[model samples]
Target chain A: MLSVTPQHFLILSFLLVGIGFLGLLIRRNVLLMLMSLELMLNGINVALLTFSRVGSNLDGGIFVFFIMTVAAAEVAVGLALLVALYKKRNSVLSDDMGLLKN
Target chain B: MNAVDLLFWLFAVLSVGGGLSMVFSRHPVSAAMFMIVSLVGVAALFVLLESFFLAILQVLVYAGAVMVLFLFIIMLLDVGPEAGKGKLSHFKTGIFGLLATVLLVGILLTLGNSYDSLALDQSIWPELSESKDGASHSLPFSTKVSSFGYGLMTKYMLPIQVSGFMLLAAMVGVIILSKKTPDREDLK
Candidate 1:
């Protein structure tokens, strides 16, 4: 019987973070980019939970709770802004977000 | 070594596969689906961690609530990865993406040793004392929702208040962002 190590969580989380960074780099769409941001947040949640187990306290779990709360609020406000931007400019891509570059 | 470890591995595999697919899948609907799997896997991991409260919250708030908003936005937009295809510079992105992968692999190997050391130093098995072993004794943590309410009102009162404030601020910001301007012709 093998116990899963904290290292497993760490490896997977960093991998997700790397992929999220790449997604943010490669994608031009604001919506996809927001989803990528959520990916990164989930990665952090994994790290926090791993540490919580390792530390013998409920702090990391609480931190993850706070992070989840923030992530929800962010997505709500963020999607609204994305919709507004699209309604104004007819695009979700980042290049079109530079409406103030005049 | 324990039931918790077994559940952890199952959910870990589910999470990684779903997360990777979420990132790479071209279709927005597919990506959203992958995310749902990943979120569920994370919730299971929380259960394995004995944070019954967080587990149910994750499922209810993230999987149930957030995913609904995601689907709504996608449908309202009426444009997914299919509609978004054939427009970006794929070749340039592919090259840069390759470079990033190489860098990421290298960095992970160097930094990952720290994690391995921590795992080696700490005991992996759960420490089940008498309180934990008593099948007849009620578990300290009740159902997810109840324990969460207890936790929030007891040990977590301050943070919960802070989160409420943050939610209020975010709502105001959303209103400001989406509100149509006063001028009738300002939309252009």
Candidate 2:
């Protein structure tokens, strides 16, 4: 229990992704769902940094840099869309915006 | 356990616990707050990995900027606490829950099987390599900001430019999406 290994970090990454996925599925609120997406991205970052450290490679860190860039863009677009949807529907629940379900 | 080990466990629990709570929390604001907690924990993990620059970036970018955006949206939309029950029915919830569980278990099993191969016997700390001349050669991996700067300007110059373009496009898209159109009845 005293020694921390790469496996432990990997497990944490997987757990975070798992929880984020669960949130995405069960949560009806679009905002919560987007937050879950951020959680998943963060999990991936942990794994990337772990591999970067393990292989003594700097590319993984740089890749994470790009991932963050994309994530910031994604959240901006996603929230903007959410705001638009809320304005139209007057509700944040995913079930309320099911125009294509039929 | 040593200090590193202790800190690792501490932040590990903090991150994982915060993630779990974020999923189950009723209020959007609380969930966003939990995400901040989780992000801070991940930043600590980055520090443990000896990537001081990335760790600071994680804090500044995720916990600071992204989270503020989330909070602003939550408050702007006035997202109230979810009702006592979720919108997902019992059967759909059960199916999704089982799927998530199986995925997590499968990942755990795979990692466990590969545990031996993943164990590191040598120090993972990066060391800066010395160059005979001041010319740019293949840069050795290090935790120094200079290494990152050099790598970005030399090897990753294209990607950085592309990312900038992408950000610009996303900014335009957000403005278009959120702007009130004069003729569109839906936005009104």
Candidate 3:
């Protein structure tokens, strides 16, 4: 039985982050992109918790809580923006959002 | 070989697999489901780290509340499976994939190699007492709910209040933005 080291958690989390990054790149759907953002945040949460455990301190967990709070706020604002975009363009594709480029 | 290790591996696999499927699924609803699974898996990992309070919070906030919000938006939008045909060029995708893979491998190698020396010299606090029996491992610090509550109410009170205010502001903003105003047409 091998011990579950912090290194293992770090690598797994980095893998998750990479997967989320790839999803962000490949997915044109706005909703899926938001989900990818959540994935990336979750990966960062895992890393924070792992470091907290390794250091035997609670600060990391506290930071994770703050991150969750910020993530929630972000989701709220982002969904509102998405709804506005949908109302205006009748589409949720990133390509349809070029109006902001000018 | 041990129960802790076994559970860790299982939850790790579950988390990674769920995340991958969530990203790759074309349907938004199914992708949201996978996201829930991955969130739950991460919560389980939090529990294994002796952060029971955080584990429960993770489940309550992320898996429960946030995901429900996501599902509601997804259902409200009613967008069907995103049509990915002929959107981006294959060369662009290949470039993104290659870049992600290289970044992942580089991070894995660097972190894996340097991890031991990075924090090995520091004295880790709340050091768990080694127990031959797997079930006897106890948290070295008093991480009871009361202590966490005290800390939240005392030392971290300002941030908590700020977060509450932020949440309230977000709620009001969402309501205003999503409201069905008659002038919406004229504004557009």
**Alpha-carbon RMSD, each predicted model:** 4.9, 2.3, 5.2
* lDDT score, candidate 2: 0.89
Q: Provide the lowest-lDDT 10-residue window in model 3 chain B.
A: B132-141
Residue-level lDDT of model 1, residues B145-179, one tens digit each, is 65446556776778899999999999999888778
lDDT of 3 by residue, B72-154 (tens): 98899898997656577889878988988888899888887797753443332247544323222222233567645655676
Highest lDDT: give the candidate number. Answer: 2
Better structure of 1 and 2 per TM-score: 2
Model 1's TM-score against the true structure: 0.83
Question: For candidate 3, what is the DockQ-based docking class?
Answer: medium
Candidate 3, A1-102: lDDT as tens digits: 446667778888898898899899888898889989989998998898887777655557777888999998999899899999899999999988898697
Instruction: Judging by TM-score, tell me the better candidate of 1 and 3.
Output: 3
Best model per TM-score? 2
How would you encode candidate 1's per-residue C-alpha lDDT over A1-102 as one tens digit per residue? Answer: 546777777776787677777778777767778888887888888788777766554556767889999999999998998888778777777877887798
Residue B75 of model 1, lDDT score: 81
True-vs-predicted CA distance for residue B150, candidate 3, Å: 2.0
TM-score, one value per model: 0.83, 0.94, 0.89
Name the DockQ score for candidate 1.
0.49
Evaluate every candidate with DockQ and list the scores: 0.49, 0.72, 0.56
lDDT tens digits, residue span A14-97, model 2: 999999999999899999999899999999999998888877677889898999999999999999988988878899999899
State the lDDT at B152 in candidate 1.
65
